[model samples]
Target: MARVYSIVSGKGGTGKTSSAINLAAALNSLGEDVIVVDANISTPNVGIHLGAPIVPVTLNHVLTNRAEVTEAIYKHESGLKILPSSLSTQDLGRIKHENLVQVVKQLKRLSKYIILDSAAGLGKETEASILASDEVIIVTQPEMPAVTDALKAVKLCEQLGKPVKGFILTRHRWKKSEMQVENILDMLEIPAVGLIPEDKNMQKALMLKSPIVNSYPKSKASKAYFETARRLLGIKEEKGFFERIFGS
Candidate 1:
């Protein structure tokens, strides 16, 4: 059975969607079958990020019973599968959020990893995504506001009886002004799963509408994402200098 991981964040602009896409790509690179689902119905971006912003069939159709779940799935150029939600505002209300769990169950039967890129904040859509997943990977920046929101998300997941896999710290600069990894863990009480460095290549990849791992495999952010994937898969590997210093 495939494991479903809802990649969520407390607030917007936390690189949650980016982390979800890259992590799916990294797993696919390892010869694992992966599917990325845009559960962020209000602001779906998985298709946009993969250069297939508009498709005939989408998650909205599946949820509304207009199309089968399999029909909504499209294979990306990078060999990963994506089930993107409709970008149209009209389709938003058509979706029944309560069906998310069943939709995820169907998806899990089709791939090794089913990554649901959830919407930001603690809204109804986000809660449904959380309940539909096996576990959650909270994404946040290493700052006071982001960390505070991450803690709220973690607590929400706990109350819902959803296991939190860990936290992914994105756009990490390791600057003196930023909150240290230790402090973040101490505050959130969740182990650090990964740390994505701020890289211009990530922006370029976004412009190109491809995952950083595929567009610039040698970039720092790509390496971090790959490392995060490997760690999540429980694959043992040697730690690099940055990991030794920052402790991923």
Candidate 2:
């Protein structure tokens, strides 16, 4: 069965896109067929992150009746297939809300996991995307505004009948401990999947158009992503305490 997840943030620059791309790669590395659907049609970055060429066909093509969903999908060498959005400014606000749900239903049969990279802010498309997802991964930074927006998103997801699977904190400096994270979770009432500290290699990896998991597997950010994937899959037999500490 295909599990559909929506990765969203209350605000932009919360590393939501980065989280989606890296998590998708980690899941694929673990032998799961993953398709990352870049629903952030207005500002799609998955293609740029994965180093895939911007093509003529994309999610906009499918929604606009210019191409089939299958025809818009590009298979990356990293073993992750992507259904990217068009770069045309003309299609920025042209997405049909009804068609969004239809498109997701069509994609469910195509992969073991469908990770939707939603645009920041609560809009028609964002709401519909979350509503269609079975679970949500709310990404936040260790700041007040991001935390506020994340809380609103969590509430909205609950109202839409979508269970928030967990939260993921990114761009953290580790200056604060898990207590700060726990407080935010207490407000949103959701457990965290993991934390990804900010790293310079992330930008370098982005420039290279490859995920850290594949480009620099031993990096702290890469190891964090691996642990997040393991938790998401509920893999038993946890890693050694010292191994986890040393890796972090």
Candidate 3:
């Protein structure tokens, strides 16, 4: 079975989907068969980040027994396959627990890495996504609320006996920024894996519906994501100038 890694966050708009897309792209660049599963069925947008439109089939169709999971995946020329969500009529929708488990089992046999782009907040679906994964990347910003909420998610992961591989500090600006990162990690007792700087290129990439790694490979944000991917696969240790500034 393939190792699944879920990219999750506690609050909305903390760059969880961005991290998920870029990390999956980076893994593909390394010649790994990466499948990005847009598990955020309610508000799916990974396809937009990848510059791909919503495919005909999605997780919703598969979960509803309308299509096979394998048939719903869209293969990219970049070597990344994306399983986007059905953006049609998700009003008051919920993924059944049994179907979620079966979906994970089905994905395990199809790819080298199943990167689940989970939704914001601590919902039932978020909990199930984390529980199904062997490792998780909790993306957060430098703000207090983001850290506090992430701790709550960490506690949930602990309750489910899931291992949090590390935390990724997103939207960080200066090298000396995010002074609270170390405190957050110390309080949660989780390792710090990445610190992605705030870059305008990221926004431009999003607006253009292209991944930073693919659109601007030499950009700082892209390089940071590549390093994060390296750390995720144990190919390299965490190294960043901000670590010295934040003492993390």
Candidate 4:
């Protein structure tokens, strides 16, 4: 059975969607079959991030009994399959959040990893995604407000009995103003799985409508994402000799 990880955040602009896309890409690069689903039905962006802003079928169709989950699956040039939600506003009301668990169950048979890019904040859609996931990875910024909100998300996951796969910190600048890794982990009561640094190349990758890992593998962000993927798969990452000599 595939492991379903719902990439969630307590608030928007925390790079939850970006983390989901890049992590899926990184896993695929490691020879794993991965499918990313846009479970954020109301404000979906997985399709947009993958360069397929529109598709004939989507999660919305699957939930409403209009289409099979397989029909919404689209393969990106990078080899990662995505089940994106419809971009039309009209489809929002038609989605039955209760069907999400069944949809996820169907997807588990298709890939090694099923990444659900859940909506930010505590809402009906987010709740549905959380309940369906086998585990969750909370994405947050290295700041107070974001971390606070992430704590709320962590508590909710606890209440639902979902295993939190730990926190993935994004847009990290490594500046003094940002929250320290140790403190963030302690406060959230979750271990640090990955720390993605702020890289200018991310903007270029976004403009080109491709994952940073695929577009700029040499960039810091891509390297961090790859490391994150390795950690998730229980693969040990070896540091370069130069880094070992200079201290990472």
Candidate 5:
């Protein structure tokens, strides 16, 4: 069965876009057909993160009725398909946020997994993404500020009647100041689907305009992402060395 997942965050800089890209790549590598859509129409990042900063056809065009949803999808070199939004500021005013669900529906017929990278904050695009998804995964850091916003995101999901699967803790360093995984799960009342470490290779992957899973497959962060993918697919596996250390 096809499932559409929206990767949302309470605020920016929580690694939401990176999560969407890498998660999609991970699933594709595991023999699933996946498409990562940049539903963050306001401040799009998936295209930039994937190194295709600009494309002729974009989600903006699909939203504005200037193009079909099928026209906007571009397959990454790694065989992962992506539907990126236009980076132009001019398209913002003309966007039809209400049409996103329709585009997502169109995407569903084309792939098994549709990963929607939503805009940060509870904005119009964010709500549209949530409505378009079958399930949502919130991404946040290990700090209070990020976790607080993540909690807010959880409440917003409840208010909207959207089912939130779990939260992905990103850039976790296990520092004394950072919130622990158990406490975060307690506060948010959700499962920990992913616990990404603070690895420098993620930045290097960004610089290379490739997913960490593809650019640095042997890196700690890459392994975590692949593990997260397996968890999402409900594949049972033993604790990885990182999972043992992180204690998730």
Candidate 6:
């Protein structure tokens, strides 16, 4: 069955877009057809993240009926498909948030998985994406402000009648200064997709305009994202440390 997942965050800088990109890339590497949509129509970043900050046709065009969804779809070198939004401020005023549902319907016919990188906040754009998705994935960091915002997001999902697949705790470093993992899990009271460890290679991948899954496939963040995808698909995990760490 095909599934659409909206990677949402209550606040910005929670690594929401990064989680969406890496998870989609990981799912693609595992032989699934995945399309990542930059649902942050106001301040989109998927294009910027992947180095093509500008494109001929974008999600903005699709929303405005200027272009079909298929026309706006761009192929990444990693074989993952990306549907990015316009960077132009002119396009923002023209976008109709409700049209996303229909656009997503069109995408469902083309791919097994659709990952919507939602706007980093509780905005109408994020709500539209969440409403159009089959499941919602909350992204947050190991901090009170982020977690509190994530709780609000969880409640929002509950109110909006969206099923939260789980939460992704990103940039986690097991330190005395950071919130303990146990406390976070207890506070959120939701299933955990996985924890992404802090990895310096993430910055390198950003510099290379590529996802860590492709740029540093062996890195901790990449591996964690892969594991997270496996969990999403209900794939039984390999128990061996060597296999989990270095499997083909």
Which has the better lDDT: candidate 3, or candidate 6?
6
Q: Candidate 2 has which clashing residue pairs, if any?
A: none
Model 3, span 216-244: residue lDDT tens: 89998999899888877878445556456
lDDT (CA) per prediction:
0.91, 0.83, 0.82, 0.90, 0.91, 0.91
Score residue 172 of candidate 5 by CA lDDT.
83
Model 6 regions more than 4 Å off: 239-248
Per-residue lDDT tens digits of candidate 2, residues 1-248?
A: 88999998878889888999889999999999899988888778788888874887999888888888999898888888899887777976667855877888888988888999988897776787797688999999888888889989998887888899888889777675433665776776787786888889999999889988888888888888888888788774356632353332
Write model 1 residue lDDT over 50-152, tens digit each, in one string.
Answer: 9999999999998898988999999989998999999899977667998989998998889989999999889999999999999999999989999999999
Q: Write the per-residue lDDT of candidate 5 for residues 1-248, one digit (tens) a residue.
A: 89999999888999999899999999999999999999999999999999899999999999999998888989889999999998899979988898999888888899999999999898888999999999999999998889999999999899999999998889989798889887897899988889899999999999999999999999988898999999999897697653674455
Q: Write the per-residue lDDT of candidate 6 for residues 1-248, one digit (tens) a residue.
A: 77999999898999988999999999999999999999999999999888879999999999999998999999999999999998998968878999999999999999999999999779789899999999999999999999999999999999999999988989989899998777887888777787899999999999999999999999999999999999888897767532443232
List the pairs of residues colliding in candidate 1. Answer: none
TM-score for each prediction?
A: 0.97, 0.92, 0.91, 0.95, 0.96, 0.95
For model 5 the local lDDT of residue 89 reads: 92
Which 10-residue span in candidate 6 carries the lowest summed lDDT?
Answer: 239-248
Counting clashing residue pairs in each candidate, in order, gives 0, 0, 0, 0, 0, 0
Of the two candidates 3 and 5, the one with more favorable TM-score, higher being better, is 5
Give a tens-digit lDDT track for model 4, residues 62-93.
Answer: 99999988999999999999999989999787
Any runs in candidate 3 off by more than 4 Å, and if so which?
Answer: 90-94, 175-178, 237-248
Which TM-score value belongs to model 3? 0.91
